[model samples]
Target chain A: MKDDVTIINCQLINKAQALKDVSFEVKKGEIFGLIGPDGAGKTTLFRILTSLISADSGQATVDGLDVATDFRELRKHIGYMPGRFSLYQDLSVEENLQFFATIFNTTVEENYYLIQDIYKQIEPFKRRRAGKLSGGMKQKLALSCALIHKPVVLFLDEPTTGVDPVSRKEFWEMLKKLKTEGVTIVVSTPYMDEAQLCDRIALIQHGKILSVETPEKIIAGFPKKLYQAHSENNYLLLLEVRKNPEVKSAFMSGEYLHIVFNGEADETVPNLKEIGPSIEDCFVYLIEN
Target chain B: MIIKIDNLTKCFGDFTAVDHITFSVGKGEIFGFLGANGAGKTTAMRMFCGLSKPTSGEGRVAGYDIAKQPEMVKKNIGYMSQKFSLYEDLKVWENIRLFAGIYGLDGKQISRKTDITLKRIGLMNEKNTLVKELPLGWKQKLAFSVAIFHEPKIVFLDEPTGGVDPIARRQFWEMIYEAAEKGITVFVTTHYMDEAEYCNRVSIMVDGRIKVLDTPGRLKDRFHAKNMDEVFRQLAR
Candidate 1:
């Protein structure tokens, strides 16, 4: 399939270079993720792709339309849910959805099928003001508004950043369901665990694209023999593991400490068991090296 | 015990935000408070911090009655929320000094501790830099160090590591361990289940009540789950 979204050598500069020679492609109907921590320039790149802000150099296209030149027409074909809630605070939930629909030159009833699954959950509270809703409800309402126009592609920036785990899971399930409707979804998040849910993810950091691949391929590329160790005191173990010359890197992960040895292990720590590297482990290794 | 509460309830008109929850934390223990959205964790935490008056029940924090001695409770505890922990416009040292002064530290102590903290966090050169200019990871570390600067009896951290990079998040956990070692009880809430595993004991709240409280190992075994996330999904479902 031809690419639904494509970028070539994109660059953005503010006080510092926000995005550096970034280039990636999202296949048709695939969920693409920009995975990085805060200040890694994920937001700047998102803005450039959405045509909300112009890049300093390079080119981008969504649905075969140039982002810079064809932005007016392109805007109608893409839905953007910014990191911050952009819905009208004083407006009722129902009113916000209607307003967005009207802006796209469509009615809520015309696109009702697109948002029905999510809207129905918050439908009972449609009369409540947007600001008065709970965090989860507010997110749902924002998403509903973004989807009310039935765009070809969706842009969700950190949609689940501060959401609770249960709510985050539910939101991902909703995205998976949307994938079946042939809507190309591009999302960004600071959570490493969420990277696995995307069809492909671009690991970005320090205004640079570190890697772009499937989550499984990224984990497979982890360039070290990782080990998991448990101790009565993980903090002390972390310090001790770091002190060893054979240890490449060590940090506490969950109930145990994760360690990477420099060479062949020779009774470095008690009960050292080799373990598969997680996405977080890969991210740390990539950033360090 | 450093903290204790019984039948703590906070009701807003007809709705009960926190419904008769009871739990206790020993000195120097790392307590993980977990819950779903709108599950009443923040309401209960507010009662613990003495920021809100409970509608009913009894509680004591750091040897002061929460209902009758809110001032004392405030004095004996430290708080750091992910949403708002430090002043963005203030210089790094200025924020430290401001919080220190608010905690009743004298000028001499503030200056001495300010230098010590900046050096420890390796931000000595960035002392005069505004907090907003620092990276998110650095800001989080600075906020944590400042929260414990007063050496309060208990430190309450609400999602301290949210959105931080993996390396920095682990470094932040190391700081939590060091605080607990100094006999400062750590009361923290986080959405990350792996962080829940780092706690000495974790309590999962459901519908304004603590459904279970135990060590991570034991909780996993009891729930027959592989990890804390699985255990959480099972309980939450």
Candidate 2:
């Protein structure tokens, strides 16, 4: 089986430069995550590679088929779940699955094994209206519909954005299972913590690639000593700590504050007690410096 | 306290949309109501806001019984829907004015509140721009600002940050904090787990019932999980 999925010097422009010289590749059977905030070019890149839109500059090939030239063949081999729940809301759950399968010149029974685990969750509600199923169930139905044709490559754009936590976990587990079965998956999300779930991730910001690496490597490479600090007048302490000489960055991680220090934690704590530091300290540090 | 709900239950054609859920919000609390899509959080909020009637139960918001004084309840609370609720054909200022009028704000109050809201959302320059022309984030901010244009005692926000950027989401929460500080109870619903952690307290609903409610820290500890994501998983299982 062909392994390389390459995008080189990709560029696209509309209201803004949605993507700027973006380049990346996904190896066969690997889950590659495109991690970034909205309008960070994740969806734009997905559109280009899926042949839904053409990039003004740069080229991409998936499984040795040119995205621009082999549109029909590429369409047949890639499954895409858009950010929005774009299935036929008017139809029943069963009808939606049957419709997607038919579009690919296949039948649900033909690929039943591939979608069995996901489909079973919603099978009891097969007669229920697509719009009537709970959010988690809707997510499962979408996944089943996407996989009904058993595409070699899967592209999901923020699929878990509106899904509940349980559904999100279940979806990720399904992706891992599919990867083991040899499907190359490219998923995009703005959730920073989810970056760790991918085999490799590219952190994109403002249409540019900020960093790309394994999740552990990226966090380990974070350049400053981090500490969780809090005190009375939490907001005021955060402001004061940010002004301190030794404090590098501070951000809110739940109720406590994560403060990055330029010096030793022990030394910094004593000095910070005189002033104070809060979670906002890290966010200010990231933005200012 | 600005809002109180007791045994609130809502049903549509034999299906319980919200089942016997009860909660209350203080004057300045940022209360988060969480559930999967179609999990009944929205339905509960609607019943509280008096947009939909409860099948059986009682609710009081801003000193008005939801069933007996829905108009009074509507006059005292604001609502922003998951979908953009502003008229797309109308200009930004026009949308604000329309909502203000709906809440009975007249003349100077409408103009004054509209100006403040426009400036606060950093959309003062786009006051004349049509809602359709604005980006999703801008539209969301505008919808939120419009919802609270009358300075209601309680604001119900349904998935307010649905499709915006992290930066935009951060900014939106900042605005929420500002409102909460001014003693307006903020009732919000979202499926985003990370965002759920920002609330003063969060209630997680599953299968039309509230399964857990507490501060994020306590919920994490109660579920013996590292984060809200795991907490939800444990409870869901």
Candidate 3:
């Protein structure tokens, strides 16, 4: 299989010891996910791969070029959208896109076909200031600017964190289209639900990779049988369920209390029904015992 | 009822920010106000909390007329936002104490309640650290604890769990439920449809109007949708 991005034991020990022995590979035309919490070092890894920051140890390559040796050429083949909005807020949407294009020695018209699908969504607001755009509109504009260079590998970090549900759904759809166009899209999100959209995901926590598997396989590996109990008082139900020796762990999930039984024993709570674990459940299980 | 609103409406020039939306919040109930961006949910909430003046109609929050007695309403309710306002330079314990002082809590009361709060949230060790030194999850939880430290009748949270991971979000919801058990009304706004399930009742707004208001189960069944996300999509469309 052809790999568009590869990392080998990347380590960084900046302020808080960000990354440690992190490594992952993304195949060409695949949507790879780095899923984790806020301090999980996802951003640090993206920076190293994008040639913004050099790793303390290990090596990374983008599109078959060494990230350290071919740093200059590597910059042209990659586009990175940082965790926070990094565009010129004072400039209009079209101005931001044109600025990035000019810096890359290219023009928006030159790469019109590359970012046409994304650009057209926000084209109506082309004259509006970037800062005045809504959260979803700002994200779309940032994505359009990132693709203005027509790079091979696209890096998106927590693009939909504060966006509404409808916009989040639409953003994922756009990413799926980009994948079909042979762009190796690497995105990171704290929301496990978004992980399901990626072709493959790596669950990271505390600067360490917990598991690397497809969303289905990861959930399938949840060791114990899970059950959901709905009682009048969910908080009380959580306390009561945890006190049971037969229960391994119990946590409130939305309206229901999700529990993992110690073993298949009798003494089931009334109205207890078996359920499947979601990506978040699997992530919690992987992080803890 | 902890809150009572009748024909609440607000306008800016020729645009109506909130239409004649009438609703009441029961004491100790977890009420969810959900909507897409640019919807009137925020405006309605602002009216209830006495932050914005309504062009017409009236409401009483905590038995204080929102229009006539905005000061009393402000004193009786707690408000926390996604962009939490905390003194980043101050230590965690100092921030808590500062809020306590603002609410006119005696030193003894402040010490006792904060001790219990620290133990409850498992943040005893972090009390002496600067607020900026804490992680995002911990900081959010701390902000919530301070918001309710005054023990107001109703707590208004604006997208309280935005950008938080699932684990922290789950724990945050659990805390909200625990507060509800103590007869403290929780009024919150969020973009997350999943969080709406935990509310005793939810209201969705669109274009300055209340589109639907009901329990999560009933709303889903009525709209013939599997989840609140679908319900919202159907309404927003």
Candidate 4:
């Protein structure tokens, strides 16, 4: 498949240097993830690609149309779900969906097949006000609205930020299903674990791309020998592991403290055993050095 | 027990936000309350914290009946919301003073506690800086310090690490452990499945009902899953 989205040295500057010569490509029918923290340039890049904001320099094209001049035409071929909730809270679920469809010069019935999987989940609450819906329900409704137009490419910014664990899992399932139907998905998330869900992910920090590769490849690229350990005192264990001269990095992951040894191991922490790096472990290793 | 609830329920109009539920939390236990949005976790927590009266049933915190002695409950417990609850324009030290005074610390005691807290959270150098100037991680840590400055027996956190970076989240969990070690029971609500694993025990609520309550390991074993994320999906499904 051809590259549906192509970006070259996309740079944007505001009060601070928002993006620094960022460039990447999204192939057709692929799930591309932009993973980063709160202040990272993920949002700014999404804005540029969606044609909501212009870049200071460089170029970005979606479906062979320049994002700079062909934004109006580009809008027709791309759908965007912003980081924050962007639905009419006062409107009912059905009304909001209809409103989005009408603005796109289409009708809900016209793209019924496009949103069938997601829309069916919230169809029971069609008459309920969007404001009154739960966080998870609102997300499904927002996604359905984003899909109403059946755009070839979808840009989702932190689509699962404040949603619960169950809802987060369900939402990702919906994304995967959408991918099978041939939607080019570009999603940004701060959650590192979610990176593995995407076909390929870019580890971004401070408006810069640290690494962009498939989750497995990123993990395989983890340079140091990693270890996962736990003791009665995880915080103390972390402090102890850092004191070791051979240790490169030590981080807490839930109940276990993940460690990276530079050379021969010193036994400051109990139950320290060599292990493969998870996406989060790889991310911390990338940024800490 | 630091917290005890029996058959607690809260209803609004025709909607039952919290169904009849019973649970008890031991002193210094890190208890996690897990739920989908509008699953009645917030309503249940408010009733426990004495901020809202339960429609029916009984709740006791710090040996005080929440329904009858809300003032007593408030005095013995500290609460922190997702927003961190710090005045943005105020200086870092000033926020500590404000909370310390509200918790009824005397003038001399307030100053002593403020110094201790500023030093503990490693904000002694930036105590005079405006709260808004501090980073999200520091702001959250300071907010937690102020909540516990009064030395409350229990601290209730609602989504404490909403948008913090991964490293800050690790440091925050360490602070939580330090608090728990100090014999202060932590009752926290969060959407992060990994955070749930750090708790001593977690309760999953669905549609105003507590579907399951157990240690993370047990919950995972019961659901035949490898992690809290999978366990949550099984119960919530």
Candidate 5:
């Protein structure tokens, strides 16, 4: 399917539709994001593309190799970092890196340059047990292990979910640098705001993709007039605005309420002046309508 | 003030988990502790709750010296760990009773508190279910409610919403707000930028030092960031 690093359309069990007729492509050297909340089937998609599991019914391929048939060949070209910390906790940081490298039939020194930037940050703590390293350091160590084999396609599942803001920033910066070096990255995150950081993002909800576009394009596609409204009572304002017939929807954004108007903006603001909307206004408009 | 930390530091061998960091939380304030994974927020919190000893530093919680009167501090504060700390094999009610017992609650008080907590978290219908049988969201909520079973003066939550759904997170925050309204201080650490904005004041730590500490609005203005993510990016650089 198209010269993509990955393409999939599969379904899991009934507990989760888990990718209902989903089809997407990750162009070479591009950072593609799968944005969705937990149980939105992000992990299932990653596993299928990585050839760890086969989809119930769908054609899938990564790097010109069939995911269901060319499992071994596909494994050689893809690196996966699971959402949870899955590296061996009993191993030292250095040992874990070396272990992953060995599993890929490579040496840490052989691909040292590929992971040199991230590895160096945790090199000083090389002797520390994997379980004992700080969260940021653990994240770096995990990335280093993932890249130790110098794979062409990297799949990260919610890599920044629990990471601190600084670590999350550092991780994204590293991903950008990796992209410059010609690596195709496919990362998933539940945080909608992170959708802006990627080259393009596919917004998935309840196992179905709602939209696929650049963050700017998606935000610009917002259909109704939006406004930020704040009053002495923010929560009550949101509840009151949602009940108005002219208002499409209302949700909280930081200290203010974002309200979307179904009618003209001029008339809506005065009516909503008694209530209010802001960024939450834009988000609600998109979600509800 | 519900919590006070002064020059709090903790070290193991040659590595320092938490460096000298000082902060205080007033009653009813939702204080957010922001930091990288290993930036020492957890260590600093543990010390304040008397879970871990500080290599050096002085602290107090609920008007008791942390270093000298750790038991008193423990008695006054509730803690929810980053890891799922509840006993998996225990029923939801049993787990609640265990925590209540740890805080020295009597039989009648534990029963009364357990009923209220189960109902508050919307898990009263599943009180007899084993914790392991519940979903991740329910487990997280139950753990949070258990931590505060004794009506602690202050509650410390360490990455309490890591793997739950967004709707569950919103509900959890509502509970936190309810607690705050009852005059209990909330001390929490999180990586989610949206969650950070909910705190009354926040501290961002990097490399074992607190680099930014202020109300989210003030921090946003001071850093000239459109959002917390941008503020983090600027400070991280």
Candidate 6:
């Protein structure tokens, strides 16, 4: 597959390094996720790659165009939905979409097909002010506006951070449909569960990439034997498990405590059931190690 | 009960945001409030926190009437929102002191509590560090500690662990467990399904009403699901 986006040795420093030697490549028509917690420099990398800001050093290219010098042309072929709500609050949903289309030298009707699925959900409130819409409705409007020009690449920063479970599922479905249309997506999110939806993900922390691989590969790479220690009092169990000398890491995992042993198992802890590690476990382990 | 509500409803003109929701939370219980976006969770939560008036309802939070004694309700409860709970410009100790004062603690008590909180969170050395300079996890922990600094009968946390890391998130939960142990009722809302399991009981709201309310274990069995995520998906769908 052809590379749609490439970031090489990107570094941004402002008193402290926002991104340190970040490097990655996104293949055409693939969903690439930059997974990390807040303040992990996902936005910084997105800004540099989308040509919104220049990196202090290193190179980035989108769709064969240089992010620095060919930014003006690049802007036309890429859509960016920032992490924060940046749409004009006073503008109606229809007006917002129209405004974005006109600024891109296009019309809503020109590329209506691109945003038709998402736009239909919010079209009933087309005349309502963007500010009056609910969070989910506003998100739909923003996505439609971003796609109005039929951009080849879409950059969504934490699009589902606060969205509920069902809405998040629907949003990911929308992304899948967009991928079928060959729109390469570069998304960043703090949710580890969402990492599985991407073709590839880079686990970033403290402005550095920990591992870049498919979700399954990352989970497979989890080093220790993870267990779900079932107990009536998980909080107490957690504290007790952490006190054990053989325990590597222990934390609550739903109904049970997820504990990882260092080398050998401790028979004293009853119901020490083994389970596969999730991307979240891998992420915590990578960060600690 | 720390919180009791009956037929609580909030209407904005013709649109009903919270539709005759009725539920009660026991004292010292960790109650999870679950809902989809625009599902009336925030609206209902605001009424519980006394930040917004209910269009019509009968409710009591921390033994104070939500509608008739909103001030008393506010005074007896601690509230924190994920978006704007702390001041970025203030130092760690300054934020603690400021909140403690607002909660009606005296100067001496504020100073004493500030030191205790910083030490508990292992941020004693960073007392003068700006809140913004601290990591997001630490800031969240500090904000939570400050929210309950006055030892309010009940504490409301709105999506407190939104983007926190796994380790820090568990640590935050530990703090909540400790508070609940100290007999402070915890009312928390979160989108993370795994967190739902930690709650003693959870109410899943849909549209504008409480559709399902039960313990995670019972809810999973009733829904015939493996985890809270599946149960939530079923209710949300």
The candidate maximizing lDDT is 1
Query: Highest DockQ: which candidate?
Result: 1
Q: After superposing candidate 4, which stretches have Cα over 4 Å from the reference?
A: B89-91, B106-116, B122-135
Against the reference, the lDDT scores of all candidates come to: 0.90, 0.80, 0.88, 0.88, 0.78, 0.89
Q: What is the C-alpha RMSD of each candidate to the true structure, in Å?
A: 1.1, 3.6, 1.4, 2.2, 3.8, 1.5
Please give, for residues A1-289, the per-residue lDDT of candidate 4 as tens digits. Answer: 6899999998898754489878888999999999876667788889999999999999999988899999999999998999888999899999999999999999999989888878898999999999998888888999999999999999999888788887788899989888999999999876767778999998788888987899989989988788889988777788778888887877777778888777877665699888888887777777777
Off by over 4 Å in 6: none
What TM-score, to 2 decimal places, does chain A of model 4 have? Answer: 0.97
lDDT of 3 by residue, A1-289 (tens): 8799989988898986479898888999999999887778888888889988899888888999988889999999999899789999999999999999999999999988877877788899999999999888999999989998889999998899778888888889889988888899999987777898899999889999988899999989998888888888788888888789988888887778888887883356756888999998988778776
Clashing pairs in 2: A135-B37, A237-A277, A238-A278, A249-A282, A250-A281, A250-A282, A250-A283, A251-A282
Number of clashing pairs, model 3?
0
Fold similarity of candidate 6's chain A to the true chain A, as a TM-score: 0.97
CAPRI-style class, candidate 1: medium
Report the Cα lDDT for residue A235, model 6.
70
Q: Residue A144 CA error for candidate 4 (Å)?
A: 1.4
Q: Write candidate 6's Cα lDDT for A1-289 as tens digits.
A: 7789988998899654489999988999999998876678888888888898899999988999999999999999999999899999999999999999999999999999989999999999999999999877888888898899999899999888778888788889999999999999999877777888999999888899988999989888887888888776777777788899999878777677888888887878868888898888888788778
Over the stretch B17-109, how does candidate 6's per-residue lDDT look in tens digits?
999999999888999999998899989998998889999978999999998888999889998888989999999889988888887899998
> Which stretch of 10 consecutive residues in model 6 chain A shows the poorest summed lDDT?
A230-239
Segments in model 2 whose C-alpha atoms lie over 4 Å from true places: A231-251, A258-289
Q: In each prediction, how many residue pairs overlap at the backbone (N, C-alpha, C within less than 3 A)?
A: 0, 8, 0, 0, 11, 0
Backbone clashes in model 4, listed as residue pairs: none
Greater-lDDT candidate between 3 and 6 = 6
RMSD of 5: 3.8
Q: Who is ahead in DockQ, 3 or 6?
A: 3
Number of the candidate with higher TM-score, 3 or 5: 3
Which segments of model 5 are wrong by more than 4 Å? A5-8, A14-18, A231-249, A261-289, B7-20, B54-57, B106-120, B124-130, B133-135, B163-167, B206-212, B233-237
Docking class of 4: medium
